[model samples]
Target: MGTRLRLTAVATAVSAVVLVAASVLVLALFQRQVTDNADDLATSRAEDLAALAAAGRLPDLLTDIGDDSVGQVIGPDGSVLAASASLGAAPAVTDRLGSEDPVRIDLDGVPDDDETEDYRAWLVTAQGPDGPVTAVVGTSREAIREDVLALGLALLVAMPLVLLAAAALLWFLLGRTLRPVEDAHLRQRTFVADAAHELQSPLASYRTQLEVAQRQDDPAGWRAVVSDLLAETDRMERLVRDLLFLARQDSSASAMSLVDLDDVVLEEVARVRPTTAVDVDVTGVSAAPVRGNRDDLARLVRNLLANAVRHASARVQVACRQDATGSLLVVEDDGPGVDPGLRDAVFERFRRGDPARGHAAGTGLGLSIVRAVADRHGGTVRVADGGGGARFEVRLPRV
Candidate 1:
């Protein structure tokens, strides 16, 4: 399955399990709570009856208990004295237990198996001057069963709806979260197709030019032309590399593991030193580790360095540092600083400063690639204010 489907399935399964467990817990607790309520009502009635009989006001006292509990009264010797109408015909009250304490028993009138009768009753006692009077409250067991069954049905009906709502929320969030990835993918595909078509014309022209230069046999002129063609080829190679990196990042196939950013910066600085004409400076050296794809990190550093060298007239400074927020990578070029208004525009793919004045051959994808890599690493890249030059800063979380 695709990643989205797998993630959705996992989320749905976990939600279902949790919802089912919660529903079961609520149902069980509700049933127990209701049962307790019934028992408490029965006990309260038994208490009121004991008080009435103790004061010699026993006549019809059982009827008053009828409101919340089925009531029947037994004489001091355990013979029936009164019974609630709802109970219809019950057994002798003396046949039940005594004391203010309550007990559950089967009722007399309802038929059970061929040999016995069926109905349920609570047997409780009332205190008397000489002995204890019994109060029996008979109720249908079906009452408790009906309440519990209703609760179970409610949960069963609600659970599926809850699960669907949760799944829908997650699905929407996933779409929003993956929007950037999808956009990058589409942009890359378009870039590849356009790049191929654009490169074909230049390559064909260079081939034709080389053939004509060869025929001339003029060493100086031919060498200059060959140099220009080689430069174009290098620009094409850089563009291809950037496109590949972006594709890998969007696919999330790039290796993301823990590495020391300080070390990577040092290595890149060393690599750039031999080719760069301007002086290089490294500062804030520390073991700043972060989780990232090492090769992408190297590419990001290389592009930033190349951009600095291409534009800097006097100095290029590279620094690595860590702070509370994250690891910071700063590259500054002591050349003509970028115009304040154009800093944002410079990062766009194929955009360059003063294109009319001609720039060293470049595919103009460096900054775009840098931003893509930073995003993959869950970091950011932005312009930093430099006193008399342009500065680009990259920030990533330190592990």
Candidate 2:
């Protein structure tokens, strides 16, 4: 949030600077055009008057420019030849240019305190009969100043409104985009609480059964009951372990490492053979290295083997080989192959195929765990036809 606020501030500052620059450009263009128009008008009038003075037609030309604008002509000695009353009584061009260079000056010709005030002037020059004549054309400075002030005020008002609108848009878009993250967090929290509650019941039942068996007088029956309870406890433990492994896979903090594919498969097959008919057959096994958590990869292999053993009639076959692309680990069972339509569904959590066929004892999380581990390693698992049995294949990239 702090970073976003800072970004918003930076955006506003950049917008303000850009708007101010545009307004400055507009104001400069307006001023240049206005001043150019004024200069052209004054120069044209001065030329007309200079021609009149040369032809001795001052009265006629002066009448022609009666009430248009203030005008004045000055000689080499800075003396005014003819001046207009549109310019109120004030210092002549000669007086205003008292020691300064004879340049244009924008100022009032009359005291602003007086009513019916005339505020105008134009300093100019022309070719007189004896020498070059100087003329001063005058106009009101108040109107020009007001126009500039109004331009500045408009820019100042409009810039903030634009920035405010932009900031509001940015805030709304950020909120909407991040809403999914909030929902994901809420879902995870709910899953954790539910998992804890689900785990408590089985654990409590196992503990009660064990305590009752321990206090019984006849030891043989109690021993068998205690053994079954221990088995149930171990099943719960395995489920919890599988759940923890999946939770870690979901977390963003986890990482993978390069592992030997052949070694992982052999090790897991050896680990599960102590309790089942686990057979590993690697005719052309590739010693390819892949990126994955060694422990999760081993667990994935174990789960696939365990699932096969639990349902196999006679044996489980494990094969590791490579193709043109990457390494492949195939676990085949001589039991009934999964139905063609149900292959994809078998990988889902708690999914059992044709429960009427056989009651296979499993927590139903094994294949799901296998899929998650394979996915984290940038690999995939699929079930395909294996002649007369089920074939589970895990394919991973060679690193």
Candidate 3:
């Protein structure tokens, strides 16, 4: 069975057992209480009759003896003396009489008109004007049985409905709870497939280059082939490193501390200047302190700078400063700007910017990493108009 169905079944089964036990207990307690009430009534009636008989004031016909009950006064010779109107000249109710002051009995086939019924009877003896007499009082068990039966029927009908409701509620809640798990599973599968595809190209190129190099004997040709191999190796290493970093970010929380955002920006700009001809302008840089993992913040700055530098036609503007709400960092490049439509898509893993704007040189994960770091630090990153080029903005809460 499916997870939802299995869980629902288990939960419903437990509820069913509990409900059945509770219903049975309720019925038992209710039956006992009603039976006790009936017995008490019978005892009370019998005592009243005995008191009357001992005083020699007993009536020929017993009256006001309560509902669904009968009373009889029997002589020592087993002869009926006085009886409830319902008994109507019947013989003695029972021949089994004990010498005890009072006794209770569960009797079946007690005369009720032409038919017989069950009763709970209480018998007591008292001295009359002439001799000792027995007073018997009993309440029918039929009403008690009918009441218990009705309750049992009600529970029998309601239990399934309640169980069905509980099961349906569990099914709905479980589906909602597992939705995120299902989505994460889907994302993991997609990520693995994409990673494999990304790694395949460089591996194939590296193998083909190795095959070509094996056929060459000239040292110069071999040196050139070695350069190509080194470049491919560097490409693969960068891809692997990026992939591992992303995976780590997914599974772990980074250590955080107060970091200087402008310092990171300037350091990355300085690093890029020595490698690229693009003019790196940090004239707009200012102090912007924020709390985050220093290494991750540095990576975020590095990726933004790398993306701008890779695409910049001539100049890249870097700026960081403190604002009322938090720190604001902006990087703008004088290159083919990102299409407004592709701005959000650029931050997705393995997603690249417009090819008409610039060559896609990096592993296409730089922007993704930038956004990931920003999010981890409770910040937001977005693309905005940069006059003639693309502008990336990051906002982080102040420490």
Best by lDDT: 3
Off by over 4 Å in 3: 1-5, 56-68, 75-77, 98-102, 109-116, 126-132, 161-165, 168-191, 212-222
Candidate 1 residues 1-399, lDDT tens each?
A: 255566777899999998888888988898788777777776676666666666667775356654334666776765656666554344444454665457877655554334433345677776678787776665555676788898889888888898889888878787788777777767778777857865786789798888889899888897789788987778678777776666666665677899889899899889999996789888656767889989899989988888888888878988888889889999998888777777877777767654422486567778878898898888999887996888999999867
The collision pairs in model 3 are none
lDDT on C-alpha atoms for all candidate structures: 0.75, 0.70, 0.85
On TM-score, the leading prediction is 3
User: What would the TM-score be for candidate 2 when compared with the true structure?
Assistant: 0.59
Each model's TM-score, in the order given?
Answer: 0.52, 0.59, 0.84
Regions of model 1 farther than 4 Å from truth: 1-185, 197-201, 207-227, 354-358
Positional deviation of residue 266's Cα in model 2 after best superposition, in angstroms: 2.0
Candidate 3 to truth, TM: 0.84
Write one digit per residue (lDDT tens) for candidate 3, span 1-399. 276678888988999999999999999999999999988888888888887877877789988787788888887677777888766566545655534567887667777778888878889887666677788888888988998999999999999999989888988898898777766676678668878989999889888877877776566788888888898889888888887787667657999888898888888888889999889889999999999998999899999998998888899999999989999999999898999889899999888788767666789899998998899999999999987888999999998
List the lowest-lDDT window of 10 residues for candidate 2. Answer: 59-68
Write the residue-wise lDDT of candidate 2 on 327-355 in tens digits.
88898887778888888888876676645
RMSD of each: 9.6, 7.7, 3.4
Query: How many clashing residue pairs are found in candidate 1?
Result: 3
